[model samples]
Target: MSRTETAARVPTLATVLDVIRERVTVSRVELAEATGLTAATITHAIRELIDVGFVHEVGTAASSGGTPRRLLELEPTACYTVGIQLDRFTATGVVVDLAGHIVARSSMAGAQEGEPAEVLRFVADHVNDLLATAAVPKSKVLGVGLATYGPQDRTAGVLLTAQPTASWLEYPLTETLSEALGVPVLIENDATAAAIGEEGLGGARSSFATVYMAGGIGAGVVLGGQPYRGATSNGVELGHISIDAFGPACSCGNRGCVENIAGPTAVVLKANTIPGLADRLRLRGDTVADFERIARAATSGDPDALSILEESAAVLGTATVSLVNLFDVARVVIAGAAFATAGPLYRDAAQAAVDRAAFMRFAHPVVVELSDHVSDAAAIGGAVAVLRRSFEARTARSGAPAGR
Candidate 1:
């Protein structure tokens, strides 16, 4: 089909493709049932997908006293996309194929006091290096996805908050990055991206919540197989959830926000009060590094380090109870670099809290688990976001109703 025809069919094609990717290998009958699309529509979408080299018949599945049905699966090498998680202290980039597997990865210093132009340039360079390392040509790349902190405008493709510096506020992030990288650029909230990535990993439950921590803490919720992006796509601010009204003030003009009280920075600050603890753990001034050091020490059975982390975990658990009560999700996923070493402690704490205090504890148990991606969840999610944007246009420009 011509490019114009393909573009016109994007909404339907994307919907069918998403179901196939999620199911891994599915027959047309299953696709139609899963997507609520008619069998003829499924056939047309599959034909287009096959013709474009994005999918292929894998094999046939056993039938229930009927002809064996052909199964289809994504063509992993049909295209590639890049995902970058940009933090204040560190940045991670990953080259992902259509199957959501990371082919190559890279990490480097973050935006840290850098101007928008310089940071975008660095990210562009990093993406190029990643593409070269993966041996994937730029022409095969669909686009780039950026995951970062928010309180901003996604439609404008610029950060609204002056985090790290005032210069970042309202910066033309997508436009500049797109110009430098020669591909479309999309931005997503880090925690939301991580949740999307986790969901894409395939799970028994379609609804869950993700708690993400790196330089800070936040959350994302997926309900009924869709991301619950609130008005403006900045809904789940788990970090800013106030845990104590009379405690220390937070930068977000709140009193004793959970992050301000028990986040990585808070845990590190609490550790600093112990004489010689900083030297003992070789605590760096950087919040992420210091938190990791403390977690490592705790993992090694250091009483002081363990106590500090436990205290922080307890506070976080309290906040998580609130999240459970509000969202009523059956599962919670802990993800991000901060959990690389101490994930279990936080998971156990969250699980215990939910078991003890969740409002729906009588109805069902809320399971808390650590994410498989850990440090790269957001980056991988960013890449998935790009793929979704290209393959799953939720709305068609021609005003046709999108396929479910």
Candidate 2:
């Protein structure tokens, strides 16, 4: 074909593949109808995908007319991706297939609260272990998707700010991980990853916007199915967004930032000081699980525990109200180890605040729900992130992925 002819021809092959992959199964007639392409074109595209191992003939569909149609499904195991979630204290690695299903996962404890190198090493170790246990073939694996707390330079794949973490300043995360894993790496903020997970696999599947409430106070904005990762990856740092300029000094050097008033550390500090609450909640363990137990106690009517949680919930509610007003989000998904403690209380308070204070209160009621997957959401999201990139980059259509 001539260059001009080739240029004039629409490349709908990838589009058809993406739809089939996401839908999991479809008949050729359905693909033709979905793509607005002729039956011949659909046949050609399906043949190409099948020859390349991207699609397979799963089975015959129920007959609608004279003959049963063959159902085509994405060969999910044909490709795999790695995902990593890096936080202040530890890192998690997960492996997932083309369809965003987790195949294996591994985690390791480290001083991620300290420095980037320490945390990156922890991530690498976990990745190695996950790959080993899954016995994934290297040729079939696509790449890695990394989720981190950040003021990130997404294009440069670097963390732009000096964090409490040692050596976190302008760190080359993607390059380093790519060098170590020998695969392409895509990096995104934790909230962004969580938002994508929800977009791709969670409650937000049908919603255009969602708020991912997590480790620190923040919201992920997905407008029209695409995560709006601002000019910098530092978008929607609700934790740093000020609600009370003079209330309390926040670690981010801002007074009364949401994180200072409502983050896990802040809640723990406030809860521990309460009289009689410490013994009943048993907030003495090293893990966030311990804090969750305390929150559970508060939910069960422990007065002192309830007071501490209520106070923190008030702060979180205030911050959430501000976010709801700014974005008019359709749904909010609250997750993280902290929320696991008193998620119901936090969710109730947050919804109450939004109902009372959101600027668009009369438009529609925003859905507020807790993330059932908890910490696993981030890890699962990381995997989804890779599959998402692989799909979009190859197909060239930027589709918004629902949360995992």
Regions more than 4 Å wrong, model 2: 1-24, 28-52, 66-68, 206-210, 285-290, 395-404
For candidate 1, give the lDDT of residue 170: 96
For residues 280-346, write the lDDT of model 2, one tens digit per residue: 6677744455567767778788777777778878888878877777777767777654665577888
lDDT of 2 at 149: 78
Question: What is candidate 2's local distance difference test score?
Answer: 0.70
Q: Poorest 10 consecutive residues of model 1 by lDDT?
A: 394-403
Residue 157 in candidate 2, Cα distance off native in Å = 1.9
Against the hidden reference, what TM-scores do the models get?
A: 0.91, 0.83
Q: Which candidate tops TM-score?
A: 1
Q: How many residue pairs of model 1 clash at the backbone?
A: 0
lDDT string for model 1 (1-404, tens) is 44444444554665677778788999999999987878887887787678768999988997788899999999999999899999797689999988777899978887888998898999999999999999999999999999999886888899988978899999999999999999999999999989988876564247899988888899989886667789999998999998889989988999989889888989999999999999999997988888999999999999999999999899889888998889999999999888999999999999999999999999988999999888898898898788777764422333433333
Could you give me the TM-score of model 1 versus the true structure?
A: 0.91
Q: Name the top lDDT candidate.
A: 1
